[model samples]
Target: MPRVEVAEQPGVGLDGSARPSEDVVVVRPDAVIVLDGATSLRTDLPSGGWYASRLAAAIAERLEEPHPADPADVLAAAIRAVSAENGFVAGHSPSSTVALLRWTETAVDALVLGDSPVIAFGPGGPTVLADDRLAAVPRRGGGGYRTRLRSGAGYGPDHVAALRESGAAMDRLRNREGGFWVAEADPAAAYRARRARWPRAEVHAVLMATDGVSCGVDDYQIFPDWQAVLDLARRHGPRAVLDRVRAAERSDPDGSRWPRPKPHDDQVLVLVEDMALA
Candidate 1:
């Protein structure tokens, strides 16, 4: 048997407004799913938060069916279901990143799209499954693109316009040639996601997290490594890891230390422990 626990927290925008968090966490006896909705650059379509929640629910429903299916097939089906329900056209709606893990009596399977990650801890140590192609997209403004968004001195209308143009360019590259893939309206992208499998006896625990919780280690270097993260979760639970991330973000409110587009992002973490040891 496996025991699962989860924790989540919504992030506030720069304007000090409360909006729905775009992260979703789903846990089952033999599986875990984590999704992070991409922020929408267009205003004419549904918000990413709405898309993520709906997609997550759809995936959950599919997983509940008696017949087992490949994770990629399940995700593809869920994407189509959500798109049909919302009347969203491909390449015109909001999208999300996905990370999934499923375990059976003999093996464990995993998938990752966009940047969210699924990590497995085994007798050999920890193995991280992530997709970094999205982050490799070229930026037009070198490194100061995020700094220009702040008001007071360096902000300018031209900078904002440039940022918008850059965003549009990135959107075009999505799900196309020389570009990365995500859980968008296009079901074909699901097949392009990274996938892996391992013997069930080799894994002791697993963790699925959106970028918000992972950024603390991958981006901020707040902790020494991923092992530190697992240890913290084991001692204080998933919320403790999220609280540490929020505290780190608060300390760098100006983005001086970490130059990211948003001050904080919605955080979601799920931990699955193998109960056989107990």
Candidate 2:
């Protein structure tokens, strides 16, 4: 069995009430699962966090069922259940991004929906398992692409100028038209899961995190160094990282620290290790 560790923080609201952020790290008979909820600014209720927690719980329950189905099928069923439970009609109010990791004796499978990222670190570096939803936005002219700053340090006149130039680059990208795009969570297509073998030599750690944690993260496009992140979490605890990200966003004038909006979204990070140690 694999042991899992999870951390999460809440978001502040207008009336001084802090909305709950949902996260879970569970070890089921089939696999270890990590999930994060997506909060929307448009909603009056706390659907994001609410759904995140509910979804994770539901997934866990399904996995524990006598005849657990495929991970992908189970996820799709959960999405449909949420829609029925909430009366959330099609093309309307959705809940959260989903990231799941299923480990069998021979192979491991990963499934993700939306921009929330999941990463795996083996003997080499980190291999990103999911896509960043925001990366799909088209630049102004489609000539260049806009890159978000990892932190306050990424902001400046030069970066701003590049952002403007990237508008054209984005337009160019739009013209090509044959690339991956981030669309709304598809309870169906997002169901396609990927699988890979766990190398006996180099499998060390796998990290699953919501986008909020990515705000202050660097070299993330590549596999992030798990030890370094673990060190930070150990010294300051998870909330410390969220605090720094919030401060970094506030320090920037351009609002470039988007996604890291004030009050900040709930940050969820889950770290997993191979069961060989056990």
Alpha-carbon local distance difference test for all models:
0.82, 0.56
How many clashing residue pairs are found in candidate 1? 0
Candidate 1 per-residue lDDT over residues 1-278, each given as its tens digit: 78898999998643445788888877777778888988776779777778888998898888888876899999999999998888877788899999988877888999999899888898778899989888787666543456554432222344445556677888888988688899989998899999989888888888888999889889899987778999999999989999999999898875657756567788998888882343
| Sequence-dependent TM-score of model 1 | 0.91
- Sliding window of 10 residues with minimal summed lDDT for model 1: 150-159
Query: Tens digits of per-residue lDDT for model 2 on 95-141?
Result: 56667776655555677665566667666666777654336553344
In model 2, the worst 10-residue window by lDDT is: 174-183
Candidate 2 segments whose C-alpha is farther than 4 A from its true place = 14-17, 22-30, 43-46, 139-186, 192-202, 218-227, 230-260
lDDT of 2 at 136: 57
Residue 177 miss distance in model 2 (angstroms): 11
